[model samples]
Target: MNAATPLPTASARDTTAFLLDVLIPTAAKGPLMRRPRVEALAERLNLDRRAVTRMQKLEEKYPGGPLLLRLPIRKQAVVLLPEHLHAVLAGSPEPFSPASSEKRGALAHFQPRNVLISTGGERTARRALQEQALDTNSPVHRLASSFLPVVYEEADALLASIGDGDGATTDVLDWDLFITSWLRIIRRVIFGDGARDDNQLTDMLARLRKDANWSALKPQRRKTRDEFLRRVQSRINTAAPGSLASVMRGISEQDPAAPRDQVPQWLFAFDTSGTSAFRALALLSAHDEAAKKAREEIDADTTGGRNLPFLRATVLETVRLWPNTPMILRQTTTEVTWDNGTMPAKCGLLIFAPYFHRDGRRLPQADTFDPGIWLQDDVVDVGAREDWGLVPFSAGPASCPGRHLVLLLTSALLARLLQDTSFTLEGASRLSPSRPLPGSLDNFSLRFSPRPR
Candidate 1:
């Protein structure tokens, strides 16, 4: 297997032309807010595997560790290999910065003051606060034990919404069902028993989410959030036992004085987790064989198997293939060099996950669905998840703190949904017959309800 293409002068020159000609067209498309636009473009290009097809072509032509591409604005160093991922993301601090995420700024549009967008002591403090909140010993972290029951209720709610399974079917986008369920879960997780059914923040966020300049309008959005923040703070002040807002407030006052803003920012993170889980569910529907195996495992481990390895393996594999966002960025604060390329300070490090996850060298059968690799860990073997760092949840200090919660929630949702019901894909969008991986079925309707006992 090829390690990576050695960066060359000729390829650098060609990379410019390739960016202008081929790759940009494959960039994100569709609505700015309601759903992920990358998934939209992936469907358009028939590459729901998200950047996999684009990166495959780049690898063939460029043959290098990292490709230097000239966009309309500036040159970006797109790193698509594992060593470089370890080098820049996990390896160091001074050189690679989080400002690259601030550059994208979609979610940041609505919440600009987010400690997440910037770096230095502010970002560090924010990250530390989040860690404490989700830490094993934290009272807030104890809510994890309730995931399966929550999923069961949410799943049943979805079934009720879809009508009875007795010859009655409702046609709906698969994302619609998944997100509806996730929103219910997140709402309850945040507000607990007093969770408001009406999610007013959704509309304000929708209006704010666009490709245009967002600074001027961020104030308006913040005003909208102000009321919601008050409501949450009130819940905390009232000391609602077991609400996320209350838990976070408790963590803040007693443990460390994490910003009041931390709770909402952390809440916003559920957007990606929810979306990623939805993607896994969509992919699982397409691959009946994998779903069957997962069902068997679910059947076997009924009592206290909190960690369902099969479903976790399947979710990990799906996330590796199609992360919520294909592009991860880091701005260079100082000069760095590796793999025949020079990354100047203040430039960019665009780490594309789809490319690295499918680098062929790290993961054999890189194009298809395979969970045995993750399952192989229990059976004893070095799999892609461990060896190469499959980073849908990302890695290192900046990695998502709720990664474990997401895995558990996703595993529970898939296991419950697939164990009882079978969904049929309908309409123009359909999964490919051969590969059964994520294909161009982004906008399809699904109809499923619980089976009779």
Candidate 2:
């Protein structure tokens, strides 16, 4: 699974034919539609058929319902309305466990034995360890210190490759690869040096990014997961210092329960944080006006240096545009009745944040890229109550505890780039909704040139 391997390709006509004629009817019947679920959804949603067809080819596939035909394992029948998202997130722990269902498919298919994906007591324990490590008040300075250099190095690499200091065109999608690389660098920082060499983890994510059909990649992904765990366990045995691996290894030695608990902590931390950074970058690149505005704000606020306010707004705007986890899926823990309909226990529910963010009634000019929507009294007041329309980091108790850390990392990276450089899009007005890099994650390819002093 090298980076150069081309994904299976299909003609737009063939894709449309498959979807309008075959997949839609199959999906309508409540069956687990095959690799072309996006096509079926596009027909139902009346979206651009070609765009949807491309997305179908790129997205990872997953089980959709309980029954093969009559009941979907995971159906889009759940509320995509904004109010539903508010209700579901605001009602966590009582009717739903947000984190539990968040990545269930990824866990079940790839790392069934991993703690974060585990159900009941094991899930709780793994989550607790993760919370401890990710606590806002916890000593994240070490993690931050370890990550910052990597971030700078990645930015420098991108800038150097462009060769020109400013006004040079570079694909924003290529910038995404740089961001992805930086995220891996951070993971290595948090997990330990061994993570640096853990090619299996990298390959699994790379494969997952390209293959939308989840079932098709399950066997291979599982093998990669196993290899990753073996490497982590070996690292645990060595007990290297000043690393997350070392910390977990120390916990395992002192507390009997730690070995079981530590693995999921690493996985969740790496998975969620890395995804968040990548999505944030994608959103930023797509909205050039917003990115320029952020850079201007950063310039003014930093007094010719770095500014946190501009950085925060940029991150917030990006998350608003492209929530890392665009949709959150949950199974009814008990029979629940809502305004839309009555759902039985175990029925699948999907809360679509991307669509929710698009609802004009909830956000002014909702479709526009306006970072100012998050600012208050000329300050980055993300903690303010009126910021309800924004949920890139989600909300409530189960809201991403690492939200602050993500903001800081994204802000710092953007600030460094803005202060040192100026950029623009290449020929593309925005990212191609079709043929998005990695095949699934849609992102703009801006040709960035560094600013000269």
Model 2: residues >4 Å from true position, as ranges?
1-77, 98-105, 113-116, 136-142, 164-180, 192-200, 208-223, 235-246, 253-293, 296-307, 339-341, 377-389, 431-441, 444-446, 451-453
lDDT of each prediction vs. the true structure?
0.58, 0.49
- True-vs-predicted CA distance for residue 210, candidate 2, Å: 6.3
Error of 1 at 232 (Å): 5.2
lDDT tens digits, residue span 356-414, model 1:
77666666767677767666555312123546756776776666666666666677777
lDDT of 2: 0.49
Candidate 2 structure quality by residue, lDDT tens digits, 85-164:
56666766446554344345444444444443445665566556656655543323345665666656665665665544
The CA lDDT at 54 in model 1 is 57
Clashing pairs for model 1 are 5-63, 5-64
